[model samples]
Target: MIKPSSPTPDHLRELKFSCLDQFIGPFHYTNLIFFYQADAAAADDDENGYKSQALKQSLSEILTVFYPLAGQVVLEGNSSINCNDNGVAFVEAKVLDGRQLSDMIEEPNLEELKHFLPTQHFVVEDNIVLLLQVSFFDCGGIAVGFSFLHKVGDGKSMGEFMTAWANANKYKCNKCKCRCDDQFMNNFNLASLFPPVEFLRTTSLPSTTNLSEKFVTKRLILDRKKLTDLKEAIVSAPGSQLKDPTRVEAASAFIWKHYIIDSAAQKRRQIKLQPNVDQVEVVVENAFMAQHTVDARTRMNPPETNVFGNCFLIAATEIVNYNDQQQEMHHLAYLLRKAIKKIDGDYIKQVQIEGERYFTNLFQRLDPVLKGKLGLCSFSSWCRLPFYEVDYGWGKPLWVCTTPIPLKNLVVFISTPSGDGIEAWINMLEDDMKIIRIE
Candidate 1:
């Protein structure tokens, strides 16, 4: 356990989670893995030990600032945490077999990749808000992984926390102590904007934890040329809403099209198997939905980025019945773009005006999917997130990866080191994996 280097101030002793945070639940964790390859020859155990010590010491310093991470959540109310400097979980692992980072990550299996991260299951009582692990490879490559409780924050908060950790390492001095300026600080003003409430407790969020079907997470990488081609193809579609298509839009649409095609295939097979049904190939045109979490920070500047909690709202695409092959991926991309566009300044105000009711209404929209009345898929993009900016004197990571996500029908987009390529990890049923593999 890595406690704060010092005790938290009395004034900042209690920190409340936002309504959105409560709704997100502590059952889930936001996981990230950063792999770094040294420029010179592989460092020995002594050298790696020194590096780990540096990281541990720096982590202690940052906990004093990002104190919520070191605190315990009250499971009863599920509202606030006691900032008592209880500390975080930190682990260091060495590959038992003589394996290098490059070999391990070359063709990453999501389940195998998860081993590098911490906290596969959350122990509710402990309320250890954050857990970090440092995995050492035989060839000096290091993988820094973390498991952050979802209720504490979202992707934006996790990104900023990483930045804070990196800064703490960069700004620290062994000789003397110095107070960092406001630029290095973060605000917890979200509680004021979206205060803690018991009303939202009844509202249910989508979960796949109890799923009967075996789920698998697969990563699909689109290189620069492939991504560019996809964008061009999407833009070239006649009557497409897209003037210029983004990687997320193009990729989302591409996956959506496949899903629709697969749905049609599934329908045809069912029809053939049914006793009374006509044995004919059925081309099913189903209404599907797309959901994405849009960070409010993306629409803000400066200080806004530093204000964290669950600072994001869901962007749900319009009900889509995609049967037209000529429309291609453009239609779905347009729908996604439209949904995301609604998350503007006006929408932010609506969230304020409607308060927590807005979130309730937004989640209620997914009732159809929750009831199995609508086809659904969720997308979360970390392409331009601060995961790329993490530098602790040794320099930025060589690669950034996510752990196994149990949520079925979810696509997580991470950016390649080049920033031009996209690595999309899709979590779906084991049977669906065959369909995905073919595509």
Candidate 2:
């Protein structure tokens, strides 16, 4: 365990959860892995020992700024963090396989890659807020695994924490104490802005509709050429409603088109298998839903760029006629853009004014998916996030990866090292994957 170098002040003992944070359940973590190549110039017999000690010390110093991380979640009435400076969990391991980091990064194996992290899917049902694991490879490379509680914040919060820790570790051996302490000391104002709305996640609205089925995660790299081609194809079409769609927009549209086509085909096959099926009654109109997770930090009227809390909106787009628009990628991309554009300043302001009404609309939109009437596929993009900035005195990471989440029909987009290619980590039902996997 690594405690804060300095204790948390008594006045700031409790960190309340924002209304958005209350929507996320307890004990779910945001897990990510960063691989670093060992610095050849700093070679020594005690490299691992020195690195571990330096990491622990820097972590202790940085914890003072992120005090909530060193505390436990108090789940009595309104969930809050007990910032008593109890500290966080840290672990150290050395890989004995003698394989270099380069051997496995070309096309990562999500199943075997789970060994690098502390958990398979970041669910431990524990009150601990965060844990860090630094695994040293036999070839002198290093893998850093970070698991942070989801209830505390979203991906943006975790990214800021990781960047701060890296900055601390970068100046550990040096005499610059200022570098170890993050400059942003303002306490997060999310709790004050959006107090916890208990009804958003009460027991009365439990997620009992969850399907118990096996899901598999797969990674695919979409290079720059493919993305450019897709964007051009969409924008060049006459009377196109898109405004030069971004790489993520184009890529997501492409995938959604294929999913619609294949799933509609699968539904036809299943319908034929049933002898008494009424063909006219089973018209699969808009069976698939496309949802995109957007960070609301920049979308706010007065942006909350540095705040730490759960602040992402899932903008879901519905296809009214999937059969007609299954192959129309341009129309699909345009509709996605339109949906995302609707979640602007006015929408968020309305959300803040009427909390219950916002959740009512949310549940109403989710009712069909929960009832198995619609397919749910949400996209989360970390392409422009703060992963490449991590440098723990050795250097920036050679590769960055997020562990597979347990949720099915989820797609995560990550930028490659070159920043020109995108890596799509998709998770879906085992049988549905077979249909989507078809070339």
Best by lDDT: 2
Candidate 1 lDDT over residue span 288-407, tens digit each: 788888888656433266677888888998877646653368888888899999888777766756666786776678777666656788998888787878977667888898876767
Clashes of 1: 0
TM-score of each: 0.91, 0.93
**Model 1 per-residue lDDT at 141:** 81
| Model 2: residue 327 alpha-carbon error in angstroms | 4.5
How would you encode candidate 2's per-residue C-alpha lDDT over 1-439 as one tens digit per residue? 8999989888889888777777676357788899988555543449788988999998998888899999887766546789988888898887766766777587667887777776554554356788888888766788999888887878888888888888888877342654434355674678776666777545223242234777787787789998899899899876678968999999888888888888877887787798698755466433777889888889988887888888887788964455664458888898789889999999988877776677777778878777667776779999989698888878888999987776767889999888998988887878889999522
lDDT of 1: 0.76
Off by over 4 Å in 1: 39-42, 122-125, 171-181, 184-186, 202-204, 275-285, 300-303, 325-327, 437-439
